[model samples]
Target chain A: MSREWVPFGALAATVILIQLVTMFTNTQYYLTQLIMAALYSIVVIGLCLLMGYAGQISLGHAGFFAIGGYTAAVGTTLNLLPHRDHVLVRMAERAGLTIQTTNSWGVDILYFSPWITLLAALLLSGVISLLIGIPVLRLRGHYLAMATLGFGAIIYYILLGSRFLGEADGIYDVPGFGLPGGFTFDGARNNRVLSYYFVWALVIGLMVLMHNLVNSRPGRALRAIHGNEPAAMAMGVDTARYKLSLFVLSAVCAALGGVFMAHYNGGMGPTEAGTLKAVRYVAIVAVGGMASLWGTLGASVVLNFLSLRGYFGSLDDAVFGVVLITVMLVAPDGILRRLGMYTLRRNRDTAPDAFPVSAEKQVQRGTA
Target chain B: MSSELIIQYILSGVTSGSVYAIVAIGFNIIYNTTGIINFAQGEFVMLGGMIAISLVPFMPLPMAVALAVVITAAVGALAQIAFIRWLKRPHVLQLIIITIGLSILLREAALHIWDEKVRSLPYFTGTVVTSVRIFGAYVSPQVFWVLGVCGAAVVLLSLFFGRTLIGQAMRACSADPLAATLCGINQKNMVTLSFVISAALGALAGCVVSPITQTHYECGTPLAIKGFTVAIVGGLGNSTGAVAAGLLLGIIEAFSISIMPMAYKDIIAISILLAVLSYRPTGLFVRREVGALKEF
Candidate 1:
């Protein structure tokens, strides 16, 4: 009944509930939506850390996601160094070894292995985040947002124009993650259940990691930065270092999500890098509440599921935009936080000691 | 490069640069009056183009364009009065998110009404592809129209800000909101006026440029990015700097296409943005005091 364990308990219960539903329905369709929601939750949670906690905004997190997806897609399709004198080949030659090459129909033989591609995607996104964040993070508020927005635009336009990355058509037939037991996660047949469980496991793991992160010292530092940067800096926090590291960390999270998403859909498109997609992620975070990790997780689940189901059809972006605006206007702290407040107020006389002090102050500061 | 090619690049760059300048000025108008960066600024340009193209069937070309500008400006003012005016102790992020929402709403509404088809307007003077040869390069008459309108806007904007009492009052409000309020200037009305003027400016740019670039529902975001780049590179809220930065970016993009692929234009523009921001966040021409870094 301790407050700290509430989110973990909720997470376990939700996963169990999903498993039950999947059993009853025995349908891949509903599971597919849930899986995609889990993937987007990964991205939104990182964004929540940066925006909701670290006081940094990224209007271009989709760029990082796109980097991850494109890395997977292109790595499985095209030969980056097509020639014999490539660095990998040269290294292999020097090391007195022959590089392993696989011959597969539809997939490029010279391309890196799927596991290597995933690692590359994650690393590249992290490095790019560091490069972009160093300067952009120096800016505060909307200026930082604009800088990230520019970065996103650059990524999108590059993807749209580059023929090697499949242009606007995007790279298709992305190879799936392979495991030791000959299990392939390509969203096919019985594999759908495997991929669903695999992705959600990662999602739950990330939720636990994020939950612990926000409760630790660094998490408190991030909150302090969000609350008041100068004050945090005066208290001996390395504001710049924390911001940059978290920025890269968030990019890595988005990249991992992108890799899974690419394999899940069998391809990824240039639209993944679009500013609107980034806005969608931000909208999820806003709907969940800025400073509340569990709230963001819930919002991500609901919003991403609605989006994947095409609930709003062509007006999806517009609906999300309205959601972001309305949330910021009516409850800047988030809908969940408001509900928590209402519940606390209703039970204040009956259970005075049970009211969550930190949650109450967080809501107050958000509105203030 | 050949003289002809150089001439072509400069002509095209200047033409697009003028449009960017117009949009950047729109950014400046609102930024100066209220410390909010309105994301819906580009949507006004889009609205101007879409509405003008739609109106061309019912009225004369010039008349349609004029009416479109009026209507778009009215929409801009209405947006402020409807949403911004009602917020209680709204934070900066909240205001920005509202503008973003408005942009999405406007874009989707345009899509639903106009469909996904791209629309074009006739050139102001003629339908013919009449070109004047300069340095053996073919220059379209539309380029001159773009330049002339931009030049006129600069003159008119300067006059308004300098000679008109209302513009001066708006300037005062931007300089110090508290002092301006104490001096009996209505900050709310000035903010609304700034939005109206900026929207009209954006509309004029769209109306003039649509013949060459065409108009569509999705054009707003790109224009927003390019205009924002100009605004940032020139220093936010500085109209002259926005114009200079717009022209500089346009020229750089034109030249960049020669060395790199067409797709790399965006990368190059943003690289320039990042470089400028990292080295001198205030921008190229503006003093450091006017930097967008003041948000902290």
Candidate 2:
């Protein structure tokens, strides 16, 4: 347990060290993208657990993320002032779930508190994931991939088609998330440093939680299911339950990231729910080495930061597409695996003994 | 609705349904031969339309479309040889990702090569406004062209598969690759041939539907999803079932617009896809026992 904390400690130190360097170099503005990257990292690490450990590929994670973002966007932006006389609204107001705020145009409005919106976002994401996962998790391989892809496409079309969702324009001018200490999570220059640290703290906390989860009994069961579902079932492991639960968990993680990122950016777009974004997340996971949580975190931060900073320019999606094809073709296990960076425990977990000899050999061979 | 309105909706639905059927056939050919669903299947259709549109200025319409089919077929064969042929026995996940990547790459290439503007081939026999009265409804002449070409392609494909030695060899490869190899069939070439045929078929359908739907770089993804829905609804490898499913989906979509907003048109097909996946994954037409024998 003590050893398990070491890498996280190193990660924390590195996080602070980067901040300090940026401050000293007067390049603190870079922290803005870093904050966004950290949020994306939350989604990536969760996906690593599902794809790498649980052996389930979800091509619709962006849909969950968008669900969170859109929920937060809609919850806070939809003024309840007009409906304040309604019973539920008055009750909610009495319960202190509603907040009185002013929009960008200085018009007064009653809206749900950011905290309430966050809760709603997470709950909605959890429910949607559960609904999608129940039947979707039953599929295997190509069928699973297509079903999830279809789900993502559905979410995108709905977002694009719904007038209440702002149609193709999406929602903008989303109010900042307010914290207890009067700190607001937004893209304002004055709030940059605080927002950066706040986002990273949340990310680190989630990573620690995930790390603990991955080493626990449920995590072992997940790896067993990944190794051989039939064998795992024969051993009395509830494969379906484990897969479904992990799917929901990962989806909730994605939604949490989406909520915070939408607040940080002060807007959400339909493109956030698009299939390309989902594919991009998968590419980062593939690059990070599916089973290595730390690798996924590192890859997500670096790649997403670069992407957010406009380094790829007009060729952004194209670059990720190339990365996916090249990585899968050249290193199916991932770039980290190619570099021999996986831990001994991971190696042992995925050793030949854990899987059928032929499958294990094919994965290890790595080349046609 | 009036009978004329119903006839109009059915005609429109059949026009789009035939296209979806062709796309589903494209998916089935590769799936049967290799047990891999080529996610880039829709890109072949997009390429056919784009290439034909580009070529129309230099040559006659028929020649341009023929050339486009050949070129797209070559692209299909090249893609198979480059990315898939050498993979000894890739996992399904890897193949899915590779094909997805290929689709994106193809879309991006089309974007750069022909700009982002939507383009379409001229109608085969008449202008866009030219209509034929059929059972009290006015139908575009292009509708007949789409149905006729698609029908002919399906009949020709069935003949090729049932009668030709090479096509029989390909079927044998799908049945049992080891036995086919023992019988001196070149399995690799058969796989490449499957890709070529599917691509050619998709291209033909794309050209026929181009005037009605218009071709855009981003259109392939949606078409792919809709075609996939039809494929699942019809059963994975059943060409005849695909035609029925495609027409059903198309009519549902056509009638759906009367009740729902046009913006939500895509949701109709996708909802059916999810419902079918959850309840009858073996498809509406396939027997449970037969479906159980085939690997998903």
Candidate 3:
């Protein structure tokens, strides 16, 4: 029983320790950074599952992130659906949406709940991921990377061109979410601590959920696919379907991160959709042990903290690029494996089969 | 659109497409020999243009251009020798990521040297004032230079690959590195030579196009994507198909502006890229195999 609860206990302990440290030090700035780290961790965790377990690389995860963020932002700004817009009853509406005015509470309102927007964003992102994954997951290695990259580029440009999405300037005045008992989580100065706890709670919940997923039968199949796809296929694993499922899962995770981030910041921007941001996440995943969730948490906290501190300044991006190269070069198995953690390195070889080349080519190379 | 306007757009498309074709050829040269898409291919182009601009005041334009090409080639060779060749157990993903890192380093280095300002070069044939009237549309004389240089490059490259022993050795390395090694061909040297040639071609493309499009530190990434678009759309390892696809992409891009806003022009390229990849993963000009190292 203790063994089962140990991981969750450690996560809880870490959060409590961080809270204690912040409370004692009275350094709220670090709390701000921690909030951002927690947000980014949500995205990185999904990416790790996709890359480390599913044996796929997506240089376009940022596109999903943008979809989530822009969806929430646009939904609120336009008050798309499930919003009371009693004033503009005769205005234009599309996509079978009807503008019905409502003044049930004696006030005309045109505000969609942040919760509903978040849900819509998640649903939209999942659908988009499924649509994208069907064709793209069939590709292998660098071709898939290029295809995903092209997808990302398309998203970035679409955001930059569309006026309704606010184009390059992006959207602002995004509403914050509310909690029970007359409390609001609006990323305010006073309520920051509350928001931080809320976000970290979600993080811990996700980690626990992912831990279970990665230990299940599906997880075993995913590992098999990553270890050797042809062998997995021979064993009756449906590689394509599994890959697509994981792709959708990763996209949904990124979209969730993006939605919360938009609400937290009260705005969304095209910069979040760039390939550079995706690469940064990839770099962070590498810095953490690629296969270790705890390592990802550790790396995200450290790296995102340093980033928010402006420690690297103009060289922040270059530093991430360097980190990626150094990590991949020096410790392909990851930082955790280097730390002599047997559990962290479980079942995986030190030298990873990073190249998912075709079986025929592998056979030829073996002979040669 | 008027026939004359269509002719003008087609001409401009061909001119810009020639540059994309050159970059695509560079991609093919390295990919064929080493099976690595040097993400820094675009940086080589930038370095060529940047180096030539910096040297033009010190020497004749032609000499500056030639020196830039040589220097960029050396950089490419150095990249292979220093980073790629030194990998202990190199894999495809690692190779690609390292090139991405190299590209970042190169871009930052350029930023430190030239800052964020856009830089342009003088037209190869004449000043910006000089133009030629064709089909009632005024076109830059440098367009002719672009066409002439690209045509010459394609013809010369094909001839060299067909007739030259060194070129044949490079081809041999791509076809079967183990067999080539057995036959006394140094695979390492062939790969290095491929990088040099690719870089030189990229540099030449950069220098010629700088007069029209201008050069800047951030230009490499977009150029690399455009080149990749052409290479993939044409079928990855096929140079002839890359040339044809490059022209087609450019024409599509040129006409797309009429239908959409100028801001959407960039979207058009990547949209087409996504469309092609999804609908026809093997590319429009399909082939059974591509890339030099089939084992990745």
> Model 3, which residues run further than 4 Å from truth?
A79-109, A342-368, B287-296
Q: Please give the TM-score that candidate 3 achieves against the real structure.
A: 0.92
How would you encode candidate 1's per-residue C-alpha lDDT over A312-364 as one tens digit per residue?
Answer: 89888889888987887778777865677535422222211111122211111
> What TM-score applies to chain A of candidate 1?
0.86
lDDT of 3 by residue, A138-244 (tens): 87766677778778878898998999989889998776766677666667888888888889999999998888888888888888898888899999999999999
Candidate 1 chain B least-lDDT 10 residues: B287-296
What does chain B score (TM) in every candidate? 0.96, 0.99, 0.95
Clashing pairs in 2: none
lDDT of 3 by residue, B1-296 (tens): 89889988898888888888888888888887877777888898899999999999999999999999999999999978877776654666666667777888788788888888999888988799898899888889989888888888988998888789988888888778889999999988898998899999999888988898889988887788888889878877678888899999889888887887998888777777777777775567754454223332
Clashing pairs in 1: none
Chain A (alone) TM-scores for all candidate structures: 0.86, 0.94, 0.87
Give the top-scoring candidate (lDDT): 2
> How well does each candidate superpose onto the true structure, as a TM-score?
0.92, 0.96, 0.92
Q: DockQ scores for all the models shown?
A: 0.38, 0.44, 0.44
Local distance difference test, each candidate: 0.81, 0.87, 0.80
Interface RMSD of each: 7.2, 6.5, 4.7
Q: Compute the interface RMSD for candidate 1.
A: 7.2
